[model samples]
Target: MNEDQENDMIQRWVRDTPEEDLKPEDYQHIKTLGSACLTEGNSAQLLTFIQDEKNQGIVKSMGFVLIEPLVNEVVKKEKSLEHCQAAITHLTRVSKLFINHIMRHFFVSSLSSGMTFLLQLDDRKAACVGLVLSALQKQLTRLPVPYTKQLEEADEYGLCRCCTALADFTKSFVQEIKSKNGNYVGTTEDEELRTELLKFCMRSLRELLLDAELSRDRKSSLWLFATEIMVTLPAIQQSLSELLFFNSLKKSIQMDDCQSKESRACLAYLLFVQLITIESFPAVFSPVFVLQCNMEYINQLLSRYAESHLLKGLALYAKSLESVEDNSLPVSLLELQSFYNVPQNLRHILTDCPMQHLRASGLQVFQLFINKLDSEAKHKFFRCMLKTRNHAGVEGYIIKNIKNQVEFSMKPGNASKWFLGVEFLSLLGLVLHLSQGAETDLLNSMDRIMESLNLLRYLLIRDKELRSRTGVWEELCRIKDDYLKMLRVCISLSRAYYSAELKALKDNQKIKAKDQQTDCVLCRYVSQVLHSALVTFDLMESLIVRIEELTEEKLKIPN
Candidate 1:
């Protein structure tokens, strides 16, 4: 259309009585006028049209349409640099007008749309878009905070969207912008964007980000964004400490009505796990205190069936326990409930997790946590596992570690003497008994039986020392005799049962081969499993014999 015809159409549309609700066609026509302004190099005219008294209602309803085309024009690659620069300047004016005029009264969703688009653009094109936003930074800085109360009032006019977009924008420069004597490098604009974006992240942590009602996907995404900013900008760590302070953390301690407390816990989890390096973790809050404060949160996450939550919880625990000293623990074991609860969740992960890698990771963390404790803690932990944890695989692990601690304590000057006393013998008694006698399900108790045999063998091999301990050798001998006799009976019965099954499967396989039928794949699998069980029993019997030999050898030696 010619200039006069376009101007006349614009005037007619802008001056027309505002619709109660704009039709789709009305939005299209408004966008067409915005495009016309860009084409005519008079982008100011669109803003003027919005500013007109008659079009105030239309502008409030559809001002976002006016800004959209200006953003498009700035990002248009075919345009000359001069043309793009002009478009950016006009976009700045339109943005300011929208934030001041439309956003105050109604939420403007497109306020961050240009930014989202810019993120996808080539560097040069994005730079042009950045210039547009840079001009609007003053207006954006004036927008209300993104917390719920203010959002309820006016939605921060899309400031949340802006913050998320700027977060992505800030990430690209993180590696390039190095700190020199505490001042940031890069352009004035990047430094400014980083400062403003950090403020938004911290505020969100205090408010919007802390809302417990936030979806898991949303919460995780926000966490990643916030972590990137904090990691890249080390200076913000101190500011983050203020919000995540131990004393200030009491608001969410009960975790009943407060979403912020839970949210704060999540932030702490991410910071310590992903953002803060292990060596640099602040000494102000003891690792135990951090663990205590976040114990419920950690347990809640670990209890979740999702692999993501499980992994996140594991990472948090690993960091929380990294710096903790055995001596730093309180005198009352009751105070260590959180530390106590971790092993059960770790057991669940080990036995129940469908993912193999995650199970391996859980085991590594579990063993590391166990190794960090002193001998007394290890003793109590082993007893607790034997009593409460019914899973044989888990019980076997506890027994194995108990055996390890015993060996460690026996070494000269080891300082871990708790495992060498009457308490150790008592702990040993709980796990060595075959509760159901020979009728026990050998397949089910495979791990427990094997580890128990190893523990007995180790004790027997250390007979030189035990014989001098008075009553210790006699008690161990009795425990060994009873345990081995019952074990021999159970192993014989199990080997007989599985051996028959294996022979039957082999016969079945021969019949299938003669008939030229599909091979009994299931029969082969059953045979393999049965054979493995029989082999395991063989290992157990050998262990029993080795223990007896050591006992006989020790008897010949004078005390």
Candidate 2:
């Protein structure tokens, strides 16, 4: 959209929000719909209508712009929660399987977008986070094409919402753990919740990282997305450690010494870091991994490739070793350790490193993954981020870095984050498409991604008049052609989300729109769940940002 149109939409949306979120009509509508969905075998009817294309598109888009603001409002206020609590209570009364069935129907599109929208608004961040997460069941399968495609269209907004919501949802949990500040063996009840949550988080992370619909630069969203889940990890250590089987997975992928040795090593470390960041660690592992595959074999293969940029980034972020000035830290390094210590195993990469690699252009984010990566490199080749140390700024640094990589702005500019995010998504989609269900042969995908990045990188470097580091810029004549190339890749990958057909209906719109009592429960409930995650995360950020504002101080860590 042009400037005027985008601005107008924003203004209208902002102005339209109600002062008090309680809407008598919304609850009445929810109750009526709840009655229908709960009636025997009606869920199949609810499911059938949404899969209809016209029904899916209009419903998914129309809800937030119309119905969802009411949902968002109710979620933000304590008094208004009765609307949601009543809905969830009624559904629970019906059957959890019924709720799960309804959610799975719209689980991807409507729910993900709802979560994103609420996250943007800071008022109800925490509760929304919890609520949003509660929407999905374990073992979610590939949804209908129309629904999944809706998500690719909604990804940026969806991801942002999910992250913000998760961040907010986990705030209390984080604080409680921090306050306790001891070796933690959580309560069995708490441990069960933590395990369920981590399983959900890791699976989501895996999917986000693997999703081809994302662009290369926007791929960093995967990490930020991972971080939202990771930052919440320390609070649920026992559960995470217990659920992830990374060690066993690591034991299986061997790096035969051919030319692929370097790539194999990188894959191993990526998987290792993936394991470590589980928010739970060594606790979940077993000697079963040792029996399955030798560490000696792993070390033998990886040691040869460890010197590549792949492993360099891992060591810097996870271990945090100090480096001699003689060899400056690689910009692609996402996690690191200080120079002083013996190599240690912390299983805490996401909290520590934002610069983990994906796609071929890993070095693009070398500078923004952490406050430290923000440090200047060679007088403007890469400038350090000039922001404060409080949580909001910290989070912004993450967002800024993520955006610089690539995401769904639709508009292209010099932001490496946005460009690369699309690239990452596209390349991931390439592999998923190419894999056609096989384990990724990274060597081939890596080659295609590297070629794409090189072309784009050359465009960025050659554009003399480009904005050096701002988030927005005109998709001007200079880099226009290359960006189009990038855009096309994402467009193709987005097809995986497409379906052979959206079920046809006889006067379907009339049936759906007329029978207001029989609303799309999947869309309504899923949206509610999403908003909860988004609002809570944003609230925590607002709280942290507000604290920074009140104290007029930044939380500085001396180098």
Candidate 3:
């Protein structure tokens, strides 16, 4: 129709139709009028009607019928600037209205169906997302305080109502993008749009879904959205499934920054706590591969000092190691040295983590992984770890495990040659002998020093067979004597140095009180280290005298 007829119809509609009595057909006529104004390069008339205060009841009665055309016009590539602005204006006004039940349904339907389709079109996807994201942002002001019950109420802009709609909207496209079961044909442009859409969803996760201020209920809503976005996408599902199921070492993949460390931790938490409980969780492969896929990622999480990241990483590591069988790792796989990576991350938890519970849990998981290996693998790991794990506490932990394994090997009917051979002796030799900087090494590595002494004491008291082996017992004696002589020297040097330092710290008159306070703490730490060294030296001396008595007894027996 011409502009004259359109104006006449608008006048008639305004003049005659009762707001309460207008039929759907009348609303359809309003939509046509709006679309016509859009086509004619001017939407000022409809915008005026929507903007005017007196006509609001009639506009409300029309019930979003005009919005669809305005949305369509706004996304059109050939639309005039005036028309697009008017369309946006009309949308903005309707947005500020009190969203009733009909408007909520319209928004839900739009997100689930109409906008989903619009987001697929290359020509319109950007404008369509811009509009929807704009609407999503507009709802933020009206949202209740985070973690409040008021967020459960229906909102003014229907954001809470459309959460599931948005989630489902994302899920459908992800399935199509990753589906391999059918001869589903799609264009390059369509694929790009689908990929872009999912990227947009990931961006929304960081920007909108992960808002710390969202109520628990709304947070759950966003999580469901995020879950659908992750679970339905083939790449993510396949990546997680392979990690959780397969055994091969896959190449490390770098994810988008949108998959922040927080997002990754959340993903791990969901898998370990929620998804793994279901029988449908893929189990065709082994859990060992899960660690392989996630080893680096888990390390990244565990490497962080944040408790949330640490807890999530620990939980994931425990679950991954749960079903793995002892002695299941092949020699070839062990040779890859990938298993050595765990100790570096575990060091944080085992030695320096501020949280006591986390430290305890970390030690538990560390032993759990250790328990999964066989004697030969354990020996290899110990040898490799001792050489590579530079941290004194971590090295001490490895030494303690070595001692345990040696005791296990000597058990009746459980004999294992891996821990008794020259290789095993050499591993011990590395820790049992003093280096050139013996005093400094002993002072700094009190844990390693103590654990080494304990391991030597255990071997001397229990392993009677070593004396029968050619040169083994004599080499052990030589190393023990050398280690003891160095330990005695270290004890003396440490006591003298720390004592002088403490006396100097106390006697310095010119030191400021704050500076003295800090130095006093340092003095206390040094004193503690010195005390530990002295205790370790006493243990070494007792073990030394016991070894000498054992040697005398062997001499009296005669060969």
Candidate 4:
């Protein structure tokens, strides 16, 4: 048949073939004709026929039977690079025509099948892998935003499958490189092909790392992929390290100057930091550690950018040191400690940085160091912290910080303000707990109780104000109710204990042989505890009343 007649015949067959009734043999026949058209340099006719949008549902239903098996067939032939490349190119072109959930699955599966075959061909693996990856990258990039949004919002299982497939492809590609023993002694074309493949892998990783559409769980899979590559293939570690660090640094720099870019850059920085400090992986002496030895790198980061995310990244890097198993500190860590002066830096950050997040990071680093220390060291550290102005006054400082957060949240268009407020409240609770331990003398418990009541009162007022404006009373209600319940029980116990102590003091006063001064001190202590308990009861009662008013107002709102 002439080309025009053949084309007309295929078009008729495509139209006549009922999608529901089509069998494997029918798809095989179509694949055969498509392959012939591709070989005869009439790809335009073949593409136009197969890619007709009207037949998309039909084509999508036949995707696995039509495309995947053909890909497998081409892969199984152990063909020359040109043959394999042509097959992949044709498949890629056809895959682009139908971009949907079903097509993505079929396309990725086909590419994965091809990759399995290509990895076995020592001479052609580089070029073949590059082609397959390029195809996969194109398909992923072309994923419709609505589809991706669906994955992000509700289709966690589908999202996980997609992320796993991407990670598997990355793992396979890295395995191919590792199989070569980091030696690519091939022709210029082969070397260039390998370079392109590496770049493709890096780009895939970059996209995965920086993909804002992905949830943390999906992004974590990518981190696992990158860490596996870094652990198994030493050569790529340096390049991957440089890529992640530079990308994070770039984003951090942008974040410092642009408030609008903060969320994206901050997320990217956090993911990169996780990649940079793959402490969960078994320890290998990596050259990347050498970068840590230079205090100048950290100093430059601190001196150059005042962003909280950057500081948080640095804090995470420092925290990674605790993962080391040996008694002796890593030389890099020692250098970090000696030069960066982590405790001093944390003190400075806590005292100086106006941002709550930075202060939180500082606290995190301090806690990490404390946890790493021995009991004696921890004791000394706590003593030192108790004496430090910032540490001692952390409650007041954190309350002020929370007030600042509340003020910021009051601004219009702050969607995340409620979450930010919750975080600050949680932080306030933590500071209150820490302050309890800071009071070394039991005689000062009364003083600590009063301090806590004052903090709680301030928090209640602030919360009341916030609730009045935002109607965000659910969390505050829980906090207030829980505190009130606990305080009521404490007040009852204190009243009982005070009555018993008064009876004992009266008996001791009657017994002249007893130590009058000691009895007097005991009486005074009981009175103080009773006084603090009553004050706390009054404060909590006021808070409850305020909360009831807010609840009433909320209930009055029309549905």
Candidate 5:
């Protein structure tokens, strides 16, 4: 048969469900071998049959996706529900091939996404979703094992298609949960199914939290999956807390420090904070053994991945506020402090960390986290700033980047675009609030504002067309009042008996920025190190206001 004919057959196979009377066990027996076979590295047929379905096999493709995988791994002794329970654990344990096969099976390109199909199976429908989702999460976050079977994710178009499919699956799973909260004690079959599912969820997530020896490929993937699972755990609450101490102990062995340990740990902690679950915290953060982390490897990922990566991790840990259960997820702001900032090992990567693809990806991860936190959480985050006043792990960057914006006037060219964006929005917003004196930290410096002012002037000088753009002028003008408020802060802070702690940083000798001569010791000290654009504060603020006025109609720059 031609490729088209073969795809048609596979699609029909998926759409054609076996008789409804067939036991889930019988279904398992028939499909398990095919599933296992499909998982064995590259299956050109899996991709070909699924990808080229000529609008004919859409439903069949989904059916075949489930049956093919079940056929591969199901054993003769494994009964259906038991096999289903096994299915979850089996997929989690299988080599990455399983993940790839499952993912390709669910492949719905952006083009085909809006194309609807008759999806009628009840139990199997959810089972397929849970299985594939569980598998994909593992594959994406974890590093692929040595010589693991691989496929062409190299092509940009294919990656985009995969991303689209993944997004759809994630959305569907979320919607399924939102559909309703069915009664748990309603019936025997319902109870049995829930029990099996709970086990599956628990086992996979446990691996994520407590598994000590995750292969490098699985490590990162598991970290992300673990977080996504948190959103599902409220319903699976009992399973979440059910694991015995012994089981928890066994899993702890796998968490031994490899390179991404800190980031993994951070992800684990973030899940707890966001989900408010304490069920597995002790297991995941088991201080069971005193494993020393490889500080050098960590520093490298932090510096190279992003200053923001390090910052976000530290902030999430420090702001661990109260979880829903008593002391569930209990690493205090102080306990987790050691992981923040560039440790000696990672300093080399931080030296001019490029804001290229890698760092940008890290930023995306950072946003995924911060966006989940509500306003109260955000307020709590800042409150941690008070706790870390003396601790630089979290505050050093904020002080260096935002509060020290004036120093950036020197090389404004090298300043990070991310830093500049935050400088105008969050940090500066904080400064403006603090300057109001309605509730301000008098110790805050005004020199930061002056530096941003300088940076703005620099931008205006270089980009006349930008200056001419109403949006640019609007931004500068709007923030003009903010600058005045900051000026008040500088005066207030300088006038107050200084922190005395920062006196050294405030001294003239410490400054290295060339424009330092005319500025105050605080301004010079900060500007010396800052690489902000040398735009004037008022002009910078005005630029934004102009931007707002010109495009104030809320146009989306037609990207």
Candidate 6:
């Protein structure tokens, strides 16, 4: 047939076919015509046909069919860079148009097959990899926003499917690398391909993470996918080690004049933090991986960017790992020591460069670490807290900070004292945890508890002053009385609870079975700790009552 006649027939087929009615044969026919049109410099008509909303399904299907062959043709011996670029450009456009509907099958087939062909041509691999990443990023940019019910559903399904495809492509690529291993020693071209592939994967995953528009759920799903692939595939480890981790470290160490080195270091740390914090694969990620990655080297990088978000990220990452239930994961004592030092580092950060969010991050990490401590470690950990408390300088920083915040809020015409009161109460609870054993350990624990109670007393006095200034002294006094009553009730309940726990421990210890002694030791220790905690709570409540009464007496005796 003549070219015009053939073009007319293709147009009729596109215009006439109902999307649901089009069979696989019809899809092939459409794909063939589309490829022919591109070859004849008729891409405008092809694009126009594909852009129609009604033809999107068919067009998407045809895209799946056309992508592989076009990529294969570009990587052929007869093809040049221009042909490859043109093919990728066309694929990139198609990807954007139908990205939301692109399935895992399409991604896996095209990427795995296309990468296989492209790996053969060393000179063109970088250009081809760039185009591949560009196209993938464009598709990723079209992921459904996880807002509405329908969109969220679509987002979950699409993200999971895309992740599966990427995982499959990674598996195939890694397999190829393994098969070609040792056949050509120190081949720069092979290294280049490996580097490009790793960059593509890391960049693509990082793009998903850094896209503020993407919902947390979507980002988390992508994170899980990346983590799974990285952990399960051994072949990619070399590239990850060389290109993603060590290369960035090397650049950072050199401290080149260019900002790219710092940028790369930041990206490397970000990716590392993401990998370690994948909640689903806690067991899969061995503690040895952290050691293997050279924690000291990572610490050096962190030190260089001490004031940057890197420290905050590390703090948060440590916090995330604190909740893992499994103890078999290779968290060495050295790693724990490193984590223990976070509060000290944070103290420095707070002293030298105090960013509020970073301080909050540091405090969060400290709190999580304390919560994760075993019975054996509690004493040591508490000693560390005591040292931190002392190193933090003046007393009442928490109370002073809260008072300043309250005063600042009042200036903005926010007279709500209830939230402020509740916040102070919560801070008091954290202080209680910090000084749990203070009654028994007078030198370390009791002093900290006294400091906290003094802080709380100051807060109550400050609150009374603020209420007087706001002309709601009586109302605020009533609220304070009510909160005091609640504290009394809490102390009473804690006393009863601890008493019962102590009795239970005593009863359990009386058991004669040899095996029961070990259990008794644990129970006795827990009961003793509970008794001390209860005493501290009791003392704290009494102090609050006395301070409230004294403040009330002082208020009534106003000049």
Give the candidate number with the greatest lDDT.
1
TM-score of each: 0.60, 0.27, 0.64, 0.40, 0.28, 0.44
Query: How many clashing residue pairs are found in candidate 4?
Result: 0
Off by over 4 Å in 4: 1-22, 39-41, 48-113, 116-127, 140-176, 179-190, 209-241, 244-559
lDDT of 6 by residue, 1-559 (tens): 2358545644655566554565767656656776676676554455455455655545444555656555555565334445545545555565433454456356766777776776667565554655565666556656743334454346654755676566655555566656777654746655655665555554453444332122234455544555544543235334344443355323212234333333333344444454433343324444445433333333433354334334524543463455443222332443465555444555555545546776566555544444444422433343344445553332234433334444544555644343243323333344434323322333234444456556556555555444545444444455455545555565566667677878876666676454544565667678779778777776777787777787766677753
Model 6 — TM-score against the truth? 0.44
- Residue 108 of model 3: what lDDT? 62
- The per-model lDDT (C-alpha) reads 0.63, 0.35, 0.60, 0.47, 0.37, 0.50
Decreasing lDDT order of the candidates: 1, 3, 6, 4, 5, 2
Those runs of model 3 whose alpha carbons end farther than 4 Å from true positions after fitting are 1-165, 168-223, 234-269, 276-278, 304-306, 334-338, 441-443, 498-540, 543-559
The whole-model C-alpha lDDT of candidate 6 against the native structure comes to 0.50
RMSD in Å for model 2? 28.8
lDDT of 3 by residue, 269-335 (tens): 4665445223445556557766665565566567677665677678778877887886565545565
lDDT of 1 by residue, 17-54 (tens): 44454476776786786787677776455545556665
Alpha-carbon error at 271 in model 1, in Å?
2.7
Order candidates by TM-score, high to low. Answer: 3, 1, 6, 4, 5, 2
lDDT per residue as tens, model 4, 31-80: 56656655555544544555656645445544333455444444444433
- Tell me the deviation in Å of residue 539 in model 6: 20
Which pairs of residues collide in model 6? Answer: none
The CA lDDT at 283 in model 4 is 41
Better of 1 and 3 by lDDT: 1
Point out where model 2 deviates above 4 Å: 1-157, 177-186, 212-219, 239-559
Model 5 lDDT on a 0 to 1 scale: 0.37
Measured with C-alpha atoms, the lDDT of residue 221 in candidate 6 is 50
